[model samples]
Target: MTWVVLTGRQNHLDQAATPHKVITNRDYLAHPALFRGQRPKVINLSNSYAYQSRGYYASLLASSRGHRVIPTVETMIDLSERKLYEHALPELELALNKCRKDLGGSFPAKAHVFFGIGPSKAWDRFAKLLFDWFRAPALEVSILDSGEWASIRKIGFCPLGRMSEEDKKRFLDAMDVYTAREWRDSKARTPARYTFATLVDPHEELPPSEIASLRHWARIAEKMGVEVEPITKKDLARLANYDALFIRETTTISNHTYRFARRAQQEGMPVIDDPLSMIRCTNKVYLNELMTANKVPVPPTVMIAGPADFELAAETLGFPLVLKIPDSSFSRGVKKCSTFAELKTLASEWMEESDLLIAQKFIPTDYDWRIGVLGGQPLFAIHYLMAKKHWQIVHHKASGKPDQGGIKTFTLKETPPHVVETAVKAARCIGDGLYGVDLKETKDGIFVIEVNDNPNLDHGCEDTGEKDEVWVRLTQWFLDRLERQGR
Candidate 1:
């Protein structure tokens, strides 16, 4: 992916400050080369986005030419009228109220945001959410204090000339982070046809894939004429520069991973763990309903909304049942209750965070079968053993680190035919994307525990039996889609 920054005043931008190409707004609008060449991310920083203004037309023309532009024409129009942006007030106000204590007891009348970077760490989250909602190079926001809370009164574009020296420094620094200033020069390497963005979080305690495994995939992709670049949460604005997005972090609908997936989908870029899959697979309650409706084998489950429903759950599932939050992952939000008292206590604590909970009949197993399905077919199989003296495969400690049990990989032919067939059928309940179907093999039958959208594919664990072929097939799935899209 390439970047092109446009500005009304060329003097405001120093070309040497960053490696990305910076040109006058007129050049972007008048230059024939930009109109006919490869699509690049256009950063429109014109003085004003008024109707028929230079910035307005710049974004309009970029969209018409199939290039991604910031502060899109719709965004400009939304900011032009208060009624257009009223729907966003409640969300902004809620975020502000959540972080009011961190504001040092001072609520300013207004603030400036540069490339989603605010003045202090206290406003960092609010600024990021603001940028996620409205993508622009610079913004001037009016803060309204109503005694109880502060809300956004207005949102408008801030021109380059209106910025102070300090604002200019912050803007440039934020741009550096957005573009990945430390990224290696692609000019020195072989040019690829497709640019793949692998979204990851280095600090994640339990990442979906290890850093070494991600690097391995990158090496393989490079050989196949694809460029795989590692991106983080801060790189949401850079989604336009990629042909496809591969999420390598833990995905949750409430976090930046979902935002990244959604942004990629909006950009018409192929993405694994697509937004729909995330929405469906992240919620166990939804999965229970989906599997039951589709006739997929699953354990007896009950939805607990309050004490009234507890009796029904206790009667149907019996004692020693497992309780799960709607969006439990990695065995964190799941618990086992041996008696009714424990159930009540855990339910009371867990219900505070969620409106409903999932209670299932306990099906003890030495190991759970993980069937990796990609593009609607079986990709790999593994037996995820339970942690020592723990019922779950992962043992999360209070210190934030986690301990995991060993894994045993099996080839597709070696895995039981019933397990493979049942896993495939379960995965089909979700969209035809990358999925991991967890099943418990018992005397009665094979039952699907849950379908995971973003499954763990580490260096030596899940990739053991399939080895390099696993990566080859995964990369091919993305390439096939890109070719169909004619990109």
Candidate 2:
């Protein structure tokens, strides 16, 4: 991508030693030459980004033209309103309080951030975090130190001309470091047509996709001219740099994965397991109600809120029922009760953690069918057998380890059409993202258990049926969307 710097005046452009092109905002807005070629990464350094100002329009138009720009129009509007940015204060304040003594100066401290670089090394991490949240090229922040902790008082964009001589030198140096890359050179730009971010947590005990599987997907994508980069929670600030996002980690509404999905949608980037899917899939209570209202075939289930509802659930769903926490995953936070006393005890205890719980009639099947659906079609199918002699697919041990059941993979054609169709129906209710719909086949009928947003696609497991074809389809899903967006 090309780099262009837009400033308010010609003299302001003269101050920078950047190798990239620099022009006045007027020239960028009106010059036909600037508008004709490939869209560049715009560094909007105009004097003021106030609403409807020249600087504001520069960033706004850059976005509309498919150019990557710093301090996006969303960022500009966020800085304009305290209510818009206040939600980010708690996290930023926590970072500030961690290094309070290192802040040095006085009660009120002012810090300048130039492209995620702070005025001093001590403030670099905090500055990077602030930049990740706001995504502005330059920021001026005021921190007020209380007796117990420090709080953010104000945060706003810093114009290029308002800086002191020393700050200007630091700013220029930071800019040089930020842009001094081989890719920054037009002749040496990256060959890949698009960039993709795969979010993963190396430390997660049970990641949805194994590192090898992720590598396989990346290799396939790279061969097709898409660059795949693995990112973690710390890379949230760099999310906008990617053309698409694939969340390989387990998703929850309370975690960074949801934040990443939300940010990706806001930036108009294609993302798997979108925020709405995460919200709808992670909570069993929501899924239960959604499936019931849609007339989806699910085992008889009851939503238990308080102890008063336990008797009703037991009468309706029966004694040997499964109790589930709303946001549970990986067979955790699920309980099986055999009698009325056990049901009351378990439901009462689980109710403390969540306001609502799912009580479903126990369907004793040797194995549960896991139908993997992608874009409203069956991608793969598996028989998740019970763990040893246990009734659940995974049994938690007293030693704090889990004993998982064996899996039998089958192709789409080999699986029962009704099973695949029901899974697809359940998945579409969540959205067209990838899903793993668990179902149980009994004497009566096949019943939908739950849908997982972040289903396991581990190598040597779910890929056993289609092998490399699965990865190809997954990659194509992203590429097809990118092509539609004219990427």
Question: Which number leads on lDDT?
Answer: 1
Best by TM-score: 2
lDDT per residue (tens digit) for residues 341-436 in model 2: 998888878878799988899899999999988888788888999999899998998998899999998988889999988899999899988899
Residue 136 C-alpha lDDT in model 2: 81
Clashing pairs in 2: none
What tens digits encode model 1's per-residue C-alpha lDDT throughout 1-487?
5678898979978899777899988888897566464667788889889999888999999877767688789889988998998898788778767767888665788888877778888888788777877888888889888767787888888888888888888888887776662334455355456678989899998899988898788777767777678888887866766789999999999999998899899978889989999999999999999999999999999999998888888899999999999997999999999998899999999999999999999999999999999998999999999998888899887887788888888989899999999999999989889999999999999999999999998767788888888888888999999879766
CA displacement after TM-score superposition, residue 315 of candidate 1 (Å): 7.8
Candidates in order: C-alpha RMSD to true structure: 4.5, 4.8
lDDT of 1 at 15: 94
Give TM-scores for every candidate, taking all chains together and pairing residue i with residue i: 0.79, 0.80
The C-alpha stretches of model 2 lying farther than 4 A from their native spots are: 1-61, 73-99, 102-109, 117-129, 142-190, 315-319, 483-487
